[model samples]
Target: MTTLAVPAARFHPLRDSATMLRRNLRRMVRYPSMTLMLVAMPVVFLLLFVYVFGGTLGAGIGGSAAGRAEYANYVAPAIILMTVTATVQGTAISIAMDLTEGIIARFRTMHIARVSVLTGHVVGSVLQAVFSLAIVIGFAVLVGFRPTAGLGGWLAASGFLVVVTFALVWLAVALGQVSKTVETASNLPMPLMMLPFLGSGFVPTDSMPTVLRWFAEYQPFTPIIETLRGLLTDRPLGNEPWIALGWCAVIALGGYLWSRKLFAREDDR
Candidate 1:
């Protein structure tokens, strides 16, 4: 009698991740109001700053056009970054909600790739960030923010934004794992959203107090903002692109490792 050999099933992390990504994306589509609110907040900030504060801010920045145009150009990059920072907070809240609702525990019992679960949240958040960026930039153009970058520069700027979004979403994932409740997770990522204000996003670092300027110059968001501004506005890309990329790499790796450990510990429980 010949015995038949059974082939073992192959596990594919990429395929698993894609499936999870679809699941998360579907959830976003089903619950559209929250996403709309998230998009609205940044747009509100853009309108407020451009219309209300533009005259004084633009005059200070020394531009030739109407104050609105100059301020629009100056603030658009930072607002794009703000869109990213705001969008990632939702990732933290989603992950925390899953944990609280016992969804993650249910997932633990499934015979699927583990990282795929986290990848779903990360990819979903990144896509959301991209959409938010597009909305904000479209509004910026409508308000007279004309980017001087060529096609290659726009592509590079997009790549940079993707990296920043990936890093922050991973950080959000880790934050979610550590929080006891969804509310806490939602609140924890607030600092990430606020970091841009403390940096050179709104005003020139030179105009800040000596100590504040030092901190702004050294912070992670400042380089990212400067690099983005350089790419979009034809400003010299002086070392900031490399620095921002390095910062994103470090944050993403750290967050990934930390979240993995948290997930494993929770699973063992």
Candidate 2:
């Protein structure tokens, strides 16, 4: 008599992801200091930008025409963006550590779904980003950075920014997977993070040099920062909004493809 082997059916990926999320949440609860550090770093940066840099940048904040608004008002969105951007480093480093330390390999041996481990990290990062945003926004309000757009507009603006932040997460995930050392993933966000300052986030594009003006007008950060400002401050939604979204989409798609390639390569090794 010959015996034949039967293959087991694969479990649903979604169910696997749900389990990972529960595990991730439990892990986050266990490491309160880790969560607090991510939130606290951004809040400290916000303070530095608001007080130490404010007087130097001028009360107008990088020289905006809207003198009626305080410097804190102009820079609030930037700080919020920074909060999201900064946390990407933490996410990237954490992911790299897991991959390098063979923790990810250990997960592969488990009966639970493999993807959940990664998904959990992402969900946790998003939650942490949201908390950082809240911290920055709360500080902005406390410092008198009132948004003229009212509650509805503010929410819309925040939602837009969050969309950009989500796109950024894919890039971070990709980098984390590709980079060998935790340091590389940790510092990568700094270069991309400066795009906003070079664009309209800090100063008006028109007043900038002709070359910079062109870059500022066309770059993704200009549109995002401006659109966000318009949303928060009731300014007009310039072409910047659409342009910013386009840039984000392009980066997100590119980053996603590269990230997948890198992750596959690493796993095969």
Candidate 3:
């Protein structure tokens, strides 16, 4: 009995996590409108920036002849990052739903691994983010955004984006857990969506006023956007990659610890 129980305990977490992930995926399908809303914001922003603002922005960065096509290339990476942020915002909403609906309490009474609940949300969110990113990138391409990345560059950028997504999803989970209501949870991550704009996203940081430029240069999202931009453009990446990784590591660790504590506290109630 002891031997059997030992292996069962060790393997249950993986099995439970897979089960939870399927549950989340099914929920995602059942509520297609939510996914569409999340994806639409980024696509809208991409269009608005590339078509309406692109010509002027492009000319400012390059020359007048650079036009919308050039601006598309410059802004594509930021839009991709925004897609990630937007998808994770859904994670917070889902987590809030599970918590407030007493589902989490019911799960606590079950024999399944506890952490699998959160893991399921994280995994499902990461998958959704990737899918949304593909759609956004395809749209960007349709609008004249061309990347010079080779196979190696594309692979590296993909890996980096996955890491960034993982970090943000975990953070969203923590935020969702702390929210008193679903509305609050959804609002908590709204600032994340604005980070790109406040950073070197739409325009160069050097082009901003002195104080704003300083803030933009030092912010976490700026380094991340810059690193992703460099990888996608096949440009020379100096230390931005390292700084971005460091920020992700800190956010991931902090979020993980906070989430575990919150979950445990709720269990004790």
lDDT per model vs. reference:
0.90, 0.75, 0.94
Clashes of 2: 1
**Best of the candidates, lDDT:** 3
The digit string of per-residue lDDT tens for model 3 on 1-269 reads 35554454443899999999999999989998888898899999999999899999999998877889999999999999999999989999999999999999999989899999999999999999988899999999999989999999999999999999999999999999999999999999999999999998999999999999999999899999999999999878899999999999999999999999999999988
Candidate 1 wrongly placed segments (more than 4 Å): 1-10, 63-66
Error of 1 at 20 (Å): 0.5
Better candidate number, 1 or 2, judged by TM-score: 1
Off by over 4 Å in 2: 1-7, 55-69, 111-114
Determine which window of 10 residues in candidate 3 has minimal summed lDDT.
Answer: 1-10
Residue 90 Cα positional deviation in candidate 1, in Å, after optimal superposition: 0.5
Clashes of each: 0, 1, 0
Tell me how candidate 1 scores on lDDT.
0.90
After superposing candidate 3, which stretches have Cα over 4 Å from the reference? 1-11
Candidate 1 displacement at residue 212 in angstroms = 1.1
Using TM-score, give the best candidate's number: 3
Q: Compute the lDDT of residue 118 as modeled in candidate 3.
A: 97
Tens digits of per-residue lDDT, candidate 2, 116-229, equal: 666777777777778778877887788657888888997897778778877787788888887788878778777666776787766667779999899878877777777788
